[model samples]
Target: MGKTTGFLEYDRIEESYLPVDKRLKNYKEFVIGINDSQAKIQGARCMDCGTPFCNNGCPVNNIIPDFNDLVYRQDWRAAIEVLHSTNNFPEFTGRICPAPCEAACTLGINDDPIGIKSIEHAIIDRAWEEGWVAPKPAEHKTGRKVAVVGAGPAGLAAAQQLARAGHDVTLFEKNDRVGGLLRYGIPDFKLEKSHIDRRVEQLKAEGVTIRTSVLVAGKDGLGKDSKVTNWANETVAPDALLADFDAVLLTGGSEQSRDLPVPGRELSGVHFAMEFLPQQNKVNAGDRLKGQIRADGKHVIVIGGGDTGSDCVGTSNRHGAQSVTQFELLPMPPEHENKPLVWPYWPIKLRTSSSHEEGCTREFAIATKEFIGEKGKLTGVKTVRLEWKDGKMSEVPGSEQILKADLVLLAMGFVSPVQSVLKAFGVDTDPRGNARASTDFSGGYATNVPKLFAAGDIRRGQSLVVWAIREGRQAARAVDEFLMGYSELPR
Candidate 1:
């Protein structure tokens, strides 16, 4: 509402990226955020629509209009204030979130949506540069202890909120470092580790105790060769936490990677995206990884046409692969969605990520039939074309083919959280294997077990980071209300 005719006067300005050649040499963030003036112009494009669908569209329900107005008025400090009021970590979401808020923007019905994500990135980056982001430690300590398992965004948010609410919160992470997935799963080329480090320091300053490389599991303990990444040297029993902590929260990510069970899946070259991704992140963080999976000088085939697959393509390119190809089981979506029919909601459409643009041969409507290999090493992949009709898929006759693939990375999404953790806590789980819990205003996020709560992927399955933050904040409020009679923390 800062400028009524601004939408008509301004066109959307997209964030720029560093050249692929220059960026591929190193694992660092390449996104060039928009300048303040460009952000202001983008903010001006926010129409004064009576209904702010963007607010509802955003997982954390960020005050979009208020931030946009603040940016438009060149009030960077206030803009970040509004942004932080809702999102505990805007830097994370601003960099990686797909910006569902933009899809639901009123201006997007016909015109380009306002560059909300870019504005957010600019605001937060500016705030950090101006030293506006600092710790807000609780004024008084509550005589209660809380245990938060998993140091990902959800766990981080919950710990921050609970600590600010004057509770003694100890955040546990299975990995050697914090940031469950963000610390390892995501490539450093997309999000630098420094962001997570600073936030870790902020949490420490806020009086949240962080315990990394500590695994809290059931009596049996997490078995060997578990696909879930665990670098914990110390293992704490669930019973110990229940006895020491007044409340426990499970905010771990969905780490159960869906596998392709076709023949030759046992091939040495075939690996889960998680298996390959985390190694690179560790390497980027200066950890020495012997026999780390690399795509160098190999024909790489990444299965699954999702963000993870795109990430594989990018990483492969960075590894100097001979060739990179991506496969999608489903037919390609339309280049553009029908706005009239899908307004104010996420729509199905073709999305080409920066990784895809770098260099990738994308194959749609194709399924891998089998992995062809010799000497226990992958050599190629057999595939079949699919024809879809009425939501059903049938193989196309005589459409089989074999493609050279020295390394095959299965980038299909996660199915559920590691069951062992939930089992350790004696928490109930949904049919999908996610921890079963409700989001009702009263006793929300409470698991079947008393004094135990679940949020983020552990409860809702794999989702966007923004959704994880929302669940964490809401779960914190729920825990606060459970500890005290009521909670002043925002839900």
Candidate 2:
């Protein structure tokens, strides 16, 4: 710890965001960077407890205390070094990550947790500005070629790690650009595409070959920003990939959107959240749409109260939607969690997103009955209130009503990774439809196939970007061991 009584001396201070009125006008990053002095004060707030639960909270197992100490002492170069030792891309996480590490902080027991994420953001930005961040190519090549299917977080992190391990890595993405969901799924205001572009540049310098629009199995072209390269027609069969490379890794995202099956499901305006979110991102990137769905001058009903749903609210507001209402199937959670019961673990509370803070009418304990429309166009939604009893939900009698709606966004969540790709590779899937892969000590991240491996959403279903990076790093270590009979890369 930098200061013996640092935790006692300083209180946690979060980074500020641009005002809602000003930020809503354009899709650009709004969070302001913290100064060096502010970062040191925040780092000093880290208790650096004997056992850092923040590490456990972080999916990549980042050495939080060491980085905190480095930041407190104004050793930003060392801070980035410590951060890079575990996380491959702190800039990405620093911007969009939910920062579970702060939730699991020791100080959170009574007071606010240290601003670990903000300090992390400050450190990495300074490193980049001071000319400390650069590509570190492997000293020697292993002469082993690897084809990783997907350029999402998992695929990119795995490719970078393998490239650093001396393996020739060729990452394939069906999309026009890299950074899987980051490039298109997330809105530009929350995270700019330039962050991903810079990383792609750095990875190329490090010897990782990125083949975007090179869909591995005939997936749709990634509609994204103009700076990305498109190569979707190019594909590598799973078995062919296994034969060509010493080892193969599948890290595709969970793209199969969970649908809301109900009457009038075929209505023109009822669409999945993924279907709507990506289009706005494309438009922001200067793509013109012919039959694009818009919420402008219309009341919109968003089903599912998750991050994706929140995204819909933000996008709809920008489109000049007359009104936006978000619905959740479950009953409302308490405003705050029972800290003693949930401390050191992710809590289930009434968490709100920045989008929600902007403007949205949220409804809990509700279910959509049908999409009401005429002439095959959605006009309104019929819904019924619900109540929970004995761990099951039932619609309340006489609680049905119709809400005016020009668009219905299904943001419930993703069901699983696309099955066709796995089927083409003949990889077995779990009951939940994720690719079958074991996270065992002996052969971590290996699929049932001898030389094939699976990681990220392909293996673990829809999950956080941090988890994808962690698995990618671990899978790289595993592949290195399988090839050399030992490995120096950290798992």
Query: For each candidate, C-alpha RMSD in Å?
Result: 0.9, 3.2
As a whole number from 0 to 100, the lDDT of residue 62 in candidate 1 is 98
Lowest summed lDDT window (length 10), candidate 2? 220-229
Which digits, one per residue and each the tens of the lDDT, describe model 1 over residues 1-491? Answer: 65899999999999999998899898889999999889889988988899999999999999999999999999999999999999999999999999999999999999999999999999999999999999999999989999999999999999999999999999999899999789888899989999999999999999999999899997667754258767889999988998999999999999889999999999989999999999999998889988999999999999999999999999999999999999999999999999999989999999999999889999999999999999999999999999999999999999999999999999999998888888878888999999999999978999999999999999999999999999999999999999997999997
Q: Give the TM-score of candidate 1.
A: 0.99
For residues 371-475, could you state the per-residue lDDT of candidate 2 as single tens digits? 999999988899999999998999999999999988999998888887777777778999999999888858888887878889998899888888989988898
Task: Give the poorly placed runs of model 1, Cα more than 4 Å off.
Answer: none
Query: Native-vs-model 1 lDDT?
Result: 0.94
Residue 167, model 1, lDDT = 99
Highest lDDT against the true fold, candidate: 1
Where model 2 places Cα greater than 4 Å from the true spot, the runs are 218-231
